[model samples]
Structures are given as C-alpha cells and as structure tokens.
Target chain A: EADIYQTPRYLVIGTGKKITLECSQTMGHDKMYWYQQDPGMELHLIHYSYGVNSTEKGDLSSESTVSRIRTEHFPLTLESARPSHTSQYLCASSSSDRNTEAFFGQGTRLTVV
Target chain B: AQSVSQHNHHVILSEAASLELGCNYSYGGTVNLFWYVQYPGQHLQLLLKYFSGDPLVKGIKGFEAEFIKSKFSFNLRKPSVQWSDTAEYFCAVDIMNRDDKIIFGKGTRLHILP
Candidate 1:
C-alpha cells in the first residue's frame, strides 16, 4: 500500500456545512493530486499541487479549494457542502521524476445530504 | 486538451478467461500511460504504467498493457484471469506538457464469475 493516508474514510454530513478532507503522505513526494469519482464512474481531476504553496484547479471545475502547505500534506476544503459534492475523493502523490508512477491513498467517501 | 477513453464500461467473464480492456488517449505529444485498479471498499492501486521504451509494460497482478503510439492507444491485457481479478479498472494519461496532471477515463468494471 502507498504511504499516503486519508482521514475519515467515510463521512456523512448535512448540506451547507463546511468540511475538509485531509491527506498526507510519508513518501515525501513533491506532487499531489485530488480526484472526484462516483462509484463505478469516471475519475475527475479536481485539484493538484506541484509542491508546497503551488496549488491549481484541475480540468474539472470544482467548488472545493485545496492547499499544499507542506510537501506531505494536501487538504481539500468545501466552503459549503452540497449534494453535488457527494462522491469519493482520492488523493495521490508521485515523485518529481517525470517517469515515476503515482501512489494512491485508500480514498475518502463523502456524503452530503 | 487531452482525453482518455475506456471502451468497455462493464465486463463479465469466467475464471481462466483472457482479458482485454481498450484504452486510447488523444494527445499529440509524448505522455505517460497507466492502468489503475480499485477493488470493493479499497483505494485505487497502480496496476501498471508505461513511461518510455518498450511498447509492452508489465504491471502487478499478472496484468500488462501495450502502448501503441501509432494508434495513440494503450490497451490492457491479461492472459488468464481469476475470480479475484474482479475490480474496477481505470486508464489514465499524463501529458508531459502540464507537469503530468493525470487524466482518467470513465473506468471499466470487470466481473470474474467463478
């Protein structure tokens, strides 16, 4: 398994509440990414960070924001959760080398009702 | 813009069956390719990847993928599959241009019935 870990493996919260999904890796990789996926559906890139303090939105326009305060930590936050935010959030990290493969955390399943 | 496509959405097969999942990408530049698998209640795991060199790349769990640059396709194949192979498989592409922010296909769910 990847050294990456995600907190609150599963979460169910009320709509309009604020929440943050935590992701941390011990591999010391410089690149981290977040993807949103529905069960058995497509995985959409929501956010990514090249390194500390370098975060960017992905092809998918997500309402959530992400921060890369540290190399091992990347967190995604929702200002106001909604049903549309209900999905599996995946966190991954890879070495700075262009050819290295990415490793993924177990994922966080969030349900906003 | 780049895109990855998995032609098969859901597949049903019996044990010992040969497997093939089509994956094609649309990118005019050099890129990296990967296949990831996610079992029920588990996080995604890298099955294999092709960064350079040989067209055929072998991955974990007896799976392999062939990167056909001419076709702009990286299709995954396994000679013989087991019931344990049942899982959701995803094809991803990371163009060298964008710091390699990977893009994933809509995934293919395989069911290996015993």
Candidate 2:
C-alpha cells in the first residue's frame, strides 16, 4: 500500500470559501505532484514540487496554489473556491531514483456549491 | 513538449476475451513508459513499466505491454481478461534529459462483462 494520504476524502463548501486540501507522504520521496480529475476523464497535472521550497506549475493552468515547506507534506490551497473548482484532486509522490514508479493517494473530491 | 496518447477512449469486452489497448508517445529520445490502472473507487496503481531493454514487459494481474520504439508505441495486452479487470488505464511517459515531470495520456476505460 502507498504511504501517501489525502485528508477529507470528500469535501463540499460554499462559493468563495477558502479551503486547503492536505497531502502527506511517509515514504520520504523527493517529488510530489497534484492533479485534477473529473468523472470519467483523464487526470491533468496542476502543480508539483521537486523538494522543500521548490514548486512548479504543471501543463494545465490552475487557479490553486501549492506549498512544499516539508519534504513529506505538499498542500494545495484555493483562495476562493468556486463552482468551477469542483473536481477530484489527487496527490502522488515518487522517488528521485530513475525508472521508479509513483504512488498515489486515495484522492479528495471537492465540491464547490 | 512530450505527450502521451491512448487511441481507444473506451472498450467493452466479455470475460475470457483477449484485450489490447493502444498507446503512443511523441518523443524521439530515451523515455520511460508506464501503464497505470484505476479500479472503481480506488487510486491509480502501477500496472507495468518499461525503462530499458526488453521491449516486452509483464505486470501484475496478468497484464503485459510491448514497447515498439520504431512505432513510438507501447501497447498493453492481456490474453484473457476477467470482469474484475474493468477499470481505467492511463499511459504515461517520462522523457529523460528533460524535466522530471511525467506526462499522462487521456486514459482508456475498459469494461469487461461477465
């Protein structure tokens, strides 16, 4: 089983509410990523971190922001949640070793009403 | 930019039927290939991967994939599929000498009927 974990497996919040999705890993991986996915659709990378204090945006532009202050934790925050922000957020982590596979968390389903 | 493509959007098959899902990448240099499966209400799991030699790679749950460099394709196959095999499969590529980010394809949904 993967050591990565996402909090609040499901979330529902009103519009304009500030919310943060938590992600943590115990594998001591150097790389962490956040992806957005919809029902029956492909996952799109939104943000990633190489290590502490290192963050980069992914191919898909996202309104949310992420921070990697600790090696095992990478949290994403939405300034003001909107209906458009409603989607499934998945967190994953992988070692820096070459050819290694990535492990994923159960994912958080966010619903902005 | 490196990108992965899965030709089939959705597939339906019966139990004990052969299965093949097509995947192609657009990179010329060395690349690492991967196949990930997501069962219902479950997180994505690594089905198989190809990093170096041996184009033919086998994975868990009786799944396998072939990496054809000439065709820039890494197609997944299974001799006989079970109804429990129904899930979403994603093809991903990690281009060496580039960023560490792994690009994922749109994904293929497989539905196996009993």
Candidate 3:
C-alpha cells in the first residue's frame, strides 16, 4: 500500500484566496515531491525536497511554495489563488536507495473560481 | 530537458485482443525507463521499469515492454488484454541515478470492450 496521503481530495476556492495543500507520508522517506497535472494531461513537477529544510524548484515554474520541516510533511501553499491554479496536485515520496520506486498519494483536485 | 512522447492519445480494443502502446523519449545521456498505469479513480501505480539489463522486460498483469536503444523507444505490450485493463498508461524517463526527476508523457488512454 502507498504510505503517502494528500488531504482535501477536492477543494474549491475563490480567486485571491490563500490556500495550502497538505501532504504527509509514513514511509520515512527522504525525498518528497509535488506535481501538478490537469485532466488527462502530463504531470509537471513543481516542487521537491531532498531532505528536511531543503526545498528546490522543479523544472516547471510554479506559483506554489512548499516547506519541509519534518520528513513526513511537505505542504504546498499558494499566496493567492487563481483560475489557472486549478489542477490535480500529487504528492510522492521515495527512499534514499537508487532505482527505488516512488509512492504516490491519491491526489488533491483544486478548483479556483 | 528530456521529454517523453506517447504516440497514441486514445486506443480502443476488444477483450483478448493484442495491445501495444508506443513510447519514445529524447535524452542523449543514459536514462531509465518506466511504465505506470492509472485505473479509473485510482492513483498512478508502477507497472514496470527498465533500469539496466536485457532489452525485454516483463511487468505485472501480463504486461511487457521492449527497450530499443536505437529508436529510444520503450513500448508496452500485452498479448491479451482484459476488460480490467481499461485505464491510462504513462511512459516516464529519468536520468540514471536521478530518481528525483522523471519526465512523463501525456499518457495513452486504453478502452477495452467487453
């Protein structure tokens, strides 16, 4: 079973509102990532953390910010929501071993009106 | 940046029919290939991966893929597909040892007629 979990499986908010998507894992993995995907589209990595307190931007630029204080939690926050922010946010966690498979969460679909 | 391509956006097939989905990637350096499946309302799950070994690799649920170095392709195939196989399949590529970053294709949606 996948140890990763994302909260608020679905969310709807108004524009200009601040929001955060919660992500947690119980696998004790060192690597965590957040990806954004639209309906039936490719996934784009937006943020990643190699370890606690080490966050980096991914290939895709994103307006969301993430923080990793503990190994299990990695939350993505949007200062101000916009219509374009509507998409599915997926959280994944992986161990330190090379070629190790990643575990993904159920994903949180957010819609900003 | 490396990119993956899924030639077929959608495919329809009958039960017990053969299935093949083409995948190609553009990366000059050594890379790892993988196939992931997502059933309806389910999260994505790894089907199989090609790290280093024989070109042909088999995955769970009667799925297999052949990695062609020259063509930079890793196509997924199943001799006979069941109705339960109806889902979206994605091909992903990551640089060797760089498990943190993986480039994914748009994914192919397969529909099996019962």
**Clashing residue pair totals per candidate (backbone < 3 A):** 0, 0, 0
Ranking by TM-score: 2, 1, 3
Please identify model 2 stretches exceeding 4 Å from their true place.
none
Model 1, span A1-113: residue lDDT tens: 67999998999999999999999999999999999998779999999999999999898999999999899999999999999999999999999887888899989999999
How well is each residue in B1-114 modelled by candidate 1, as lDDT tens digits?
789999999999999999999999999898999999989888888899998999999998899999999999999999999999999999999888955788999999999999
**How big is the positional error of residue A48 in model 3, measured in Å on the Cα after superposition?**
1.6
- Between candidates 1 and 3, the one scoring higher on DockQ is 1
Q: Once model 2 is optimally superposed onto the true structure by TM-score, how far is the C-alpha of residue A53 displaced, in angstroms? A: 0.5
Best by TM-score: 2
Per-candidate interface DockQ score = 0.91, 0.83, 0.74
Which model scores highest in lDDT? 2
Evaluated on CA atoms against the true complex, candidate 2 attains a DockQ of 0.83
How would you encode candidate 3's per-residue C-alpha lDDT over A24-104 as one tens digit per residue? 999999989898989988888899888999899987899999999999999999999999999999998888666777778
Which DockQ-derived CAPRI band holds candidate 2? high
Error of 1 at A91 (Å): 0.7
Error of 3 at B9 (Å): 0.9
B9-36 per-residue lDDT for model 3 (tens digits): 9999999999999999988778878999
DockQ top scorer? 1
